[model samples]
Structures are given as C-alpha cells and as structure tokens.
Target: MTRRTLHAIRHVGFEDLGSFETPLRTAGYQIEYIDAAERDLGQLEPLAADLLVILGGPIGVYDHDSYPLVADELQLLRARLAADRPTLGICLGAQLMAAALGARVYPGPAKEIGWSTLDLAPSAKSQPLAALRDVAVLHWHGDTFDLPQGCTLLASTPLCRHQAFARGPNLLGLQFHPEVRGDRFEHWLLGHASELATSGLNPVTLRHDAKRYARTLEQAGTVMLNDWLAKLKH
Candidate 1:
C-alpha cells in the first residue's frame, strides 16, 4: 500500500510536529512540512494531502498585518472545511480555522500560558480526545476564538471557552499543546523565552513544571493523535 501523506503547515520551527511526529509515521504517514512564515501560501492546496495539520504558533490568526500569509491560509481552510476533509489545528491554527469559518478570533480576558486541565463537555467525552480525560494540557496562548457556527465545542478551560472544537468527524481543533514532545521540552523554553520573561515568569519555574507535566502530556498526546488518525482511517 502507498503511504499516506501528512502535510503540516508550520508557523515556527520549534512548534513543529512534536509528539504527533512519531504517531503519524507509525500510522503510515509520510510527513511533509510547509513553512507558512517563509513561503507564499497563494499556490498551496490545503487539502492536497491525506492529512493537513496546521501547527501552533506565537502569532495570532488575526495578525494579518504582520503575517500576510494568514489570509491565504484562511482561504485554504475555507476549502478544506467545505470538503469536510481531515484537518487538525493547534492553538493559533485553531483560531485560524474558526476565523476561516466566519467566527470571531480575538484576545481573551487573560493569558493562559501554563499547564491547565480542561472541563470536558459531555458530547466531547466520546471523541478522539477521550484519551486525554483528566489530562492537564500545556496552555500557551492568550487568544481565543468563538466556536464556529455548527461546530461542536469539545473542551474548555477557565480562561478560554473554545479550547477545542470539532466539526463533523473529519475536522478537529485543539487550542492546547497536546502535540508537544516532553523530551524536547527545552526547545519550548528556549523558543519562548522572551514571552516568559515578559510575563514575569522564570525559566526555572517552567523547567519544574515541565518535569511534572511534559512526560504525561507526551504520552497522552501520542495516544490522542493515534486515536484521531485512526478515526480518519475509518
């Protein structure tokens, strides 16, 4: 059988696949990355691959001025969602999906930049995220998006309402870092150092927090990605 393709739209280098890398390959996917920040997305076909994963980034989906490619990404998302194709969005990517679907993506009341547990909605308990029950996912974004019309709200935290959403069986969106790899937790610390320092948070504190949560998050993230991909296979 030919290997399935998992094409990822990456905004930043450090925020690449993470735990999703191994799970995807093990599921017979050959990963290809598209750097959204470096290239023009005008000629890109969003649903050209078997699975399209829009990875998280530090920038906002609404930051079209700074990242003009976001406009192209939105156009791509519109096509993907219209086809009910398999697409996964993380953090800023999730916000982009919402915006593409005509939902409001804006700054939240407060920054939620730490490990936090989600309040699982009853309908969400039976989906791909079933493996992440009681899991404290890494939350690192200050922006949130309204649930797109006709989309199912899957999970939420105290600071954000639309932490996760799913539309039909093909599309899933996560606002948390369930795809982060624990062994490479150092990359996250170094990659986002300025944000931590600006927030008056210490790197030492993040190291300790990583020790407590990163391992478990990695394991759960693997299971969750596999589960979601399995759903796509069916």
Candidate 2:
C-alpha cells in the first residue's frame, strides 16, 4: 500500500498536530510540517499533497497588509480549496479558509479562551464532527468568520455561531482547537499568558479545567480526527 502525504501549514512551533498525529500515522500518512515563518508558501504547489491542514496561529486574517505571508497562505488555500482537495483548518486557519472562500473574517463578540463543548447543528450528526457531539474542546481564539456560501454548519457555541463548517467530504474548518494535547496544556497557557492576563482570565482556573477535561477532550478529539480522515474524499 502506498502512503498518502499530509502537509500541515504550521504558524508556530508548539501549536502542532497533537492528538491528530497518531491517527494520521496509523492511517499510513507521511506527515510534513511547513513552518510558515521560515518557508515560502507561494513556492509550494497547493494541490500537490493528498491532504493539507492549516494549523492555528495568533494572527488575524485581516493582517495581510502587516504580514505578507498571510497573502501567500490565502493564495495557497484559495487554489487548494478551489480544487476541493482534502483540507482541514483550525482557528486562524479556519478564518483564512473562510476569507479565501469569499467570507468575512473578523473579531468575534468575545474572546473564547477556555474548555467548552459545542452545540452541534442538526446536520452534524451525519458528519465527521459527530464524534464531538458532547465533547469539550479547547477555544483559544478571538476571531470568527461568516459561514462560507454552500458550506454546512457543523458545530457552534454561544460565543461564536460559526465554530465549524464543511464544504464537502474533503473540506472541514474548525474555529476551536480539537488538536490540542492535554499533556502539553501548559505550553498553551504559557504561550498565551499575556493574552490571558489581558482578558482577566486566571491561569489557575484554566489549569484546573485542563486537569478536569483535557484527558476527555484528547480522547474525543482523536476519535473525531480519525473519523474525519476515514471519510475524506481521497
């Protein structure tokens, strides 16, 4: 059997594949991380990989003027998504996907930065996100996007209505972080410590919640990713 290639566009070192890595490997995927800061996204062929995943980052989609790389990523995503190739986007990645699809990406009503379960849309039961029906996932972003035209809304929360969406069997976008690892929860807290402080959120509370829900989320997130990969239109 030939192994499939999975290219993950990573904006940061720590925000990586997490629980999704094991299932991808078990599914016979050869994973490669494209560090957005060091690599040239425009130079790479967007439709070359069997699967392309855009990981989360702190930057906003509207920051294209400030960060030229945002333009490169947008171009890459636009080309890949136009082909309807297997693609997944999380958080900032999701926002970028929406923008590429002609939707507006901007700040949400509030910054959702904690553990919470999604309110699955009726259409989600028949979708890959059904694995996260009642599972608590990590929410660490402040940006949100309008649902792209013709995409099915999967799951949402009170703070954000467009938490997740799917254009087809090959495309999925998640505003929350289902790929976050509980064991490495501290890295998140430490990485975004300043943001937490600005939001008046206490790390002690998040630490306690991570202890309570991280394991459960990890298990559920793995299930979700595996289920999605199985149903991918490859």
- The candidate maximizing lDDT is 2
For residue 178, give model 2's deviation from the true position in Å.
0.6
lDDT of 1: 0.86
RMSD of 2: 0.8
Give me candidate 2's TM-score against the actual structure.
0.98
lDDT of 1 by residue, 114-208 (tens): 87678989888788787888887889998999899999999998879889999887889899889887778889899999999898878787778
Q: State which candidate has the highest TM-score.
A: 2
- Which residues of candidate 2, in runs, are more than 4 Å off? none
Report lDDT per candidate. Answer: 0.86, 0.92
- Reference-based TM-score of each model: 0.96, 0.98
